[model samples]
Target: MWSDHAPLTIQLTSPLHKPKTMTWRLHENLLSNPQVAQDIQQALTNYFAENLPQDTSPLLTWEAHKCVIRGILISHSSALKKAQEHTIRELTAKIGTLTQAHKRTLDDTLLRELTAAREELARVLRQS
Candidate 1:
């Protein structure tokens, strides 16, 4: 085993690497769940399309969140309900304007939107 001709295996490590995880086995008898899948795919595509940086690598990647929105979108969260009834449609329409906005302006506007959305979500979460 120590001979020069022997093959070697090496493990790679990264200081920032997190452990792998397992999630819900959603496919279990959910073969007919195409609507749920379509909703998630549409939301994910919208998120990526809207948020991807123009020319450089993005600071955040969708994979980093591991599709957390799937649970959020499906849950009976008051935040989701309230947002749909309140600002969501307006925000969605505003997305098209980002193309003409300056980067700094976009950043500030988006951060404000994110904070508002988060507060609403947190309020609903606390209630439940």
Candidate 2:
């Protein structure tokens, strides 16, 4: 006699373990911003001035300086990204509103405005 239930097979395997490493690269576009350049210069100047003590090793100071520069770049990059996102959102909303108005009246002025807004939005999206 055979049972109605089918046989089941289960396979078990160990999970793979790998070390996680983080790599950060600077966005070259940020260099074009005058504010970022100024902020980096100020941070380097302060780091050097404060670490001028004779007891500090040059190698350690150099390493620490790298960290300081990284921090500045990261902060500026984050801020820039946030601002770009905000602009993109606003442009999207403006485009939506203008498109609706243009559709309702089919006015030449509204059409022109909507076209301009769409172009602006495209530009902002490309930058981000």
Candidate 3:
């Protein structure tokens, strides 16, 4: 029998509500397995260093569906170039990790997505 006078203390928590950044890293960490979060973080940092523009905030807000690369290139201030490069590298590394995991039997849909994403990154870099 359920006690009517019992103190109802309920502690509620849900796993799905974790922040996107944490979740993003979580997926990668799980795939990579046993590596510390800092290792993943460092890998992402290195990837950014190699492929992205010096400034990438503009790219984040830039609409791929509506915006043309040429216009974006012309509009971005020189200061943002580094950020853009960094973003491209980071994004590429993250996507590439997933794409490479399957290797010989790569998922067609995922490959297309990564290819499109890389092209977008290149376009942003190519912008004059």
Cα-based TM-score, every candidate: 0.29, 0.80, 0.33
Please write out the lDDT profile of model 3 over residues 1-128, one tens digit for every residue: 77779688998879777655621111222334333334445555665565455555546534431233323233333235567778778878866775776475778877887787777867866752
Q: Write down the lDDT of every candidate, Cα atoms only.
A: 0.56, 0.89, 0.55
The numbered model that scores best in lDDT is 2
> lDDT order of candidates, best first?
2, 1, 3
Sort every candidate by TM-score, greatest first.
Answer: 2, 3, 1
Better structure of 1 and 3 per lDDT: 1
Top model by TM-score, which number?
2
Candidate 1 vs 2: which has more TM-score: 2
lDDT of residue 66 for candidate 3: 26
How would you encode candidate 1's per-residue C-alpha lDDT over 11-126 as one tens digit per residue? 99999999989654443323245655676677778777766667335655555335556463445244445765555455444543543353546677666665665566556555
Error of 1 at 110 (Å): 62
Per-residue error for 127 in candidate 2, Å, reads 1.3
Q: After superposition, how far is residue 56 of candidate 1 from its true place, in Å?
A: 8.1
